[model samples]
Target: MHEKQKARDVMTPDPVVLPEDTPVVRAAKLMRDQAIGDVLVTRGDRLRGVVTDRDIVVRAVAETRDISVTPIGALCSTHVVTVDPDQDADDVVRLMREKAIRRVPVVEKGHPIGIVSLGDLAVEWDPTSALSDICAAPPNE
Candidate 1:
């Protein structure tokens, strides 16, 4: 059997984050700049919540709430579910599936150190070899 891959193997290291007090617009900006769908909300490295593009669209824009004036804390998903670095990727996938979550924060000693998304796991596992093919291919002509 293949050795189990740990969360550390697939998680993005030192993930870009925002403070709990950051406004929703700023968090959206950070996500856009990073080309990521979500960002971990932290307080000095301690995980607090998660903000996603969907959150902005649903809770702010769709609701006609002012993104620039609303704090991320108002829209972020608190009580974040996290995974340990040593946990197997399969287990992480299971947890995410059960929770209907697309991202999992990787934490150590009560502090977040990284993040993993569904896309991350897809690339790591390459179930259909799609990710492998993409990685093996050179830039598009």
Candidate 2:
């Protein structure tokens, strides 16, 4: 039943989005404030890329970049894998597996509307699973 659901049905809507030129430090702060792992990078209303907390750590901190001045676009993963809102959730899962990605932006006309994560899938498809339990749990913070 859930497997047949569409991306729009399962995705977390109104995902946080930021401009490409925004500073990495600011993005990091926003992520912390929102308790979110990633932010969709946009350029003039068009989906550009996705930047995650991991990207900040590995690409900025580890690389000794100036987070206060470095633009998130510089570290964001631009070769993003996206799915349409009308796409099947099952197909999204398959694409995630094939791409080795944990999250995918749900786009419409090149604008991100939502995001679907592995955790979301677990909760939808196997609510009793350990992963689902963890995902459904309240945020540790």
Candidate 3:
């Protein structure tokens, strides 16, 4: 039953989105304010890329690029993988694993409508899974 779950069933609807041309610093600040790790970059209603807080650190800061001058597109992924709302969860998980990706955008008609993360798959696959437990576990001092 769990394996048959669809991407839309566990996806976070209306995820944070930004224009690809947004400055990296602005995007990072939005992420910080939202307390989210990633944002979907778009051009109008079309999905363009995905940018993570880690991307900013590893791709921009580490390279000594000026965050204020750098656009999110410069560091965000171009060939982002996506899943259909009706796609099988297993397939989504397989894609994520094969691509070493932690999340996948849920798109329809070239527009992103939602997003599914590994944690979402974990919880859907097994309610008492270790991944779920880890997500619930309190932070260590």
* Per-prediction TM-score: 0.85, 0.95, 0.88
Q: Model 2, which residues run further than 4 Å from truth?
A: 1-3
TM-score, candidate 3, is: 0.88
Prediction 1 TM-score vs. true: 0.85
> Tens digit of lDDT per residue, candidate 3, span 1-141?
554678899898999999888999999998888667899999877999999999999999999999998999899987899999999878888999999999999999889999999877776666798998875565443
Model 1 is weakest, by summed lDDT over 10 consecutive residues, at 132-141
Q: For residues 20-103, what per-residue lDDT tens digits would candidate 1 score against the true structure?
A: 888898888877776677888877668888888998999989999988889887888898899999999889999999999888
Candidate 3: residue 7 lDDT (0-100):
85
Q: Which tens-of-lDDT digit does each residue in 1-141 have in candidate 2? A: 553789999899999999999999999999999888999999999999999999999999999999999999999999999999999898999999999999999999999999999998998889999999998887667
Give per-residue lDDT, candidate 3, residue 105: 98
Runs in model 1 with CA error above 4 Å? Answer: 127-141
Location of the lowest summed lDDT over 10 successive residues in candidate 3: 132-141
Candidate 1 overall lDDT versus native: 0.84
Q: What does the lDDT come to for candidate 2?
A: 0.94
What are the root-mean-square deviations of the candidates from the true structure over C-alphas? 3.4, 1.2, 2.1
